[model samples]
Target: MDKKEILDTLKAAQVYLSRLKSLDNELESAVKQIINTFEETERNIHDTFSNLKVVLVNILNKRENFLLEQAKKAKTDGLAPLEECRNVISSKVVGTNKLITQGNSIINGSAKDGLAAFSKNASLLGSLPEVPELKEVPFISFHVDPTSDNEVKDILSQLGEVSRIAPIQITELCEKPGAILVEWHSVENDDRLTDIQEFRLQRAFGDVIKEKHLLVNFNDCYRGLDTQFLVKDLKVDQPYSFRVCCKFEGIQEWSPWSLPQVASTSLRPFSWKISDDFLLSNENKIAKPTVDSPKVLYSDGPQFCVGHSVEFTFLEIDSSNAMLGLIDQILPTSSSLTSTPGNSFLVDKSGKIFVDGIEKCTRLSEFSKGLKVCFTCDLVNDHKVRVNVDCNEKRVTYDWSIDPDYKMFFVSQFYSPNWKILVE
Candidate 1:
């Protein structure tokens, strides 16, 4: 019984196992097929969704690209006016640069080109509006008169004898005997606004005439005064031989001197018409002092005959302490250096001037700044006249009363009065 049962159970168990195995295999296969089917459906669905999303995105991008391309084509077609605008901007830049260049040319060069063009057309165009002709030239005038009896002779004697004095020159247009005029032709032609007409003259007494203080009493209508001149104080009174001279400004050159004319003092009141000798018309014995001695009369020197050069000889009195040459030039001081001839026309005589503190040099220049007296003879005429002179290295004259008794004791101590006159 056990065997049979065991066989049947084994068979039953085998069959059931076989069936189970087959069912398990079929179930497994079926599950696998289902899973595969499910996965395949999911994959298909996912692929469709992805394809749809891509199509949507591609449509959106195509719309944007088409809009951009259309806008680009519109811009290209509309560029003509923009091109014109760019050209206008560029033309403005070029015009600005041109204006700036023209402005700079005018400023940097002071508009010289414009001025040159104007000058070329001046005759027809006339001068620039409101502008006047340039008148920078100078006119000079000289006046000389010696009609008086002794005035003529006195002045002539004072003018040192020269080989040839410049002939007295007068304006050919207005020839006046008493008044002499000179023109600095070079300066006149170059800067003149008009022809010089008249000049003022100042007068004083004595050698101071060399100082050249006389103002050129000329009219300004002719032209402007030339500032380019050797401006110096000239003497007014006394005697002088003046010649008009001129020099071009900046051109360091002097024109030949004009003909010289004699200037002498007349006792009469100064008159424009009778500008020269101031003739007294009548006369007397009283006269302006002449060069007869080395001492100045009126006791003191120089003031009276300012432009006169003096070689006073006061012999050294061995017994007297008369202290060097004491010059009290008694001439009354009426005018100032510029107003009227001052005390005298004297200059520094270096060491030669010192008489107990006064000037004692015999060789006194015309405008002797200091009264100079040199000891050559004894002074006797306690009361004598006076002489005048012009100073410095120019025209010179002397005024002194030298005693005939030339030899004196001043010779023993300092002998002949030295000849020394130096201008500082």
Candidate 2:
């Protein structure tokens, strides 16, 4: 063979050798996993059955004691009247016998006191001593259900089920400035049983996984069967471990949690980092108007980059103009948001949008209380950042001349007092 053919053959051999090595490693790992699973599953099963036994025993003992006490109570209650009647009859017998002895003594002896006693006793003998008549006595008895044993056995047979844990895995993890998006799926995707009821996602601060907080949906309940979820308001630039477990339709317990995956936010956790002449509280999440004049709010300065979004929720909006604006440079304390800086874009409650203080004809719905406004900066392989505004379910996109490398900050200003804005 030529040298080229020899080289090609060697390369083929090397490729096969690499594949063989990978397969061997996979086989070894699978064996180890199998061993661990076997031991762990066995131990879990043993503990489960042990607990079941204890519970069953306790139930049986409680029922047995209850029935025994019921029987004893029945016996005591039933014998009460019969015992009282017997005592009355015995008292009458004793009284009659004493009267008989007194009469016999009056007849057999010749004393005057005996005659007096006989006279007294004769009045008692005029009528026979009253004796209580015995009626039908109470019969106390307990009967067990004929089919109870068989019924208990049947119930025990159907009490609990043993099913293998579902293999749920986290498929994707995406990190944002203050959030992480997680997506997962079941490995055993059995289409025949579309009975997945819900899924639970838990997150811990570090890799130790000691304390975990269950993630809630926007409705503030545990997440349902959706495969993807975005956990927001997380601490930025902090490592968090997350795991997911699912509940099937008939399962009482959620399936075992998936192996934890760690993800950390970059840059900063988005919050209202600065405010314009307003009192900011709750880590700058809430802005309260301190002065009767117009107030402005600002997020972290120059840190808002591409692929990031800021949401503003109006908690209380008075009868005044609420403005949403963005600026690249730091605003001078002397400069007011109403002045509209030369390098800023704003959308006011009057439905007018402005670019660099120049009014644009784009009219959006007027802002109101309880209205959610989201501003997103997106640019894919482009120099200019595309700012998209979502308000009242209406979307308007604007391409700003600002370069993607040039970071900017979001601004919200209101004219009236008692205006509360929540920044996320």
Give the TM-score of each candidate.
0.19, 0.64
Candidate 1's residue-wise lDDT over 1-424, tens digit each? 6999999999999999999999999999778756765685578667876886798689879977977787677667566555676676676566556555655666688565665544343333222223222352222233345466478567545633221222213232211112222233322333422433323222223333234444242221222344221211222333544345433344343333443334543322111111121111212111121221212212211221221222333211222111222242232333211121222223232323332233444544422224334222123354332333332433223334432222111110111222212110
The best candidate in terms of TM-score = 2
- TM-score of model number 1: 0.19
lDDT of candidates 1 onward, in order: 0.35, 0.74
List RMSD in Å for every model shown. 55.3, 6.6
lDDT of 2 at 258: 77
Q: Cα lDDT for residue 365, model 2? A: 78
Per-residue lDDT of candidate 2, residues 58-96 (tens digit): 998998999999888888887777678678778767877
